[model samples]
Target: MLDWMNRYRRNRMVDHYITQLGPALRKRYGLREQYTVPQIQKTLVAIHLNTHYLAYAVALYRHEASRNTVNLRLSQTFLDSLRAEMAKRYFHGRDSYRAHDVLGLVKTSRWRGGRSADGVRSWVAGAAD
Candidate 1:
């Protein structure tokens, strides 16, 4: 069906980009064990903050694919383990109108622009509270 195909293409096209983003994410979080993008996605959903992760993932994927990077990384809780790994960085409010929902503008420090590799900035972030 066209619907199924569209959905699949819409979602699948980014899988590669997300995988390419793996190193940046692991390095930024100082992760010891390697994690696939979907595994990370599941973790975000388990914490009930997957929506933020999805939006940010799309944005970061776009950025990596030569698209745009105007989207904000929304706020939400995360696992304490990930929290401990990522909290040392600065979290800036990206949107004043939705100040409470804004988690700040984060950029990985290893990309071409000297930002990205730790892509939780525009790709992943947070606790599960």
Candidate 2:
């Protein structure tokens, strides 16, 4: 598995992050009820693209798997590291880039706060902004 990670990391760290993250993301965030299949697919594609960029940043900084430690807990420190890296990459230099695509994934997630399907849709759509 580490070998595969190394191979993927060769091209772009984002690719490595996506390869590790895509399936987990699909399982964790893909919604069956928020929208139709086509809509969900579209959302998934957008989310995947966005996440890939984040993965790339994380990889570029040698932060692959840094978010979760051997203790098996997700660490805010890891996320802060990634976020700081992203900010530096996206905002500092003229040639830098931001993960706007990944940021867009915020709109595609399903919210379970509603009492009914319609309510959920309203809540989600409302919260999207």
Q: Which candidate is the best by TM-score?
A: 2
Report the Cα lDDT for residue 87, model 2.
Answer: 50
User: Please, what are the lDDT tens digits per residue for candidate 2 over residues 10-113?
Assistant: 44644433343333344555522122223323444655544334333332222223322323332546545655654554446322222333332334356656
lDDT of 1: 0.36
* Candidate 1 lDDT over residue span 1-129, tens digit each: 999986666445334324434434444443433333454454445444424335434333221211122223322222222222222322332211111111223334454664565666555444422
**lDDT (CA) per prediction:** 0.36, 0.41
In candidate 2, stretches whose alpha carbon ends up further than 4 angstroms from where it belongs are 1-11, 16-24, 31-74, 90-129
Residue 13 deviation, candidate 1, in Å?
3.3
Cα RMSD (Å) between model 2 and the true structure?
Answer: 14.9
List where candidate 1 sits over 4 angstroms from the true fold. 32-129
The model with the greatest lDDT is 2
Error of 1 at 88 (Å): 32
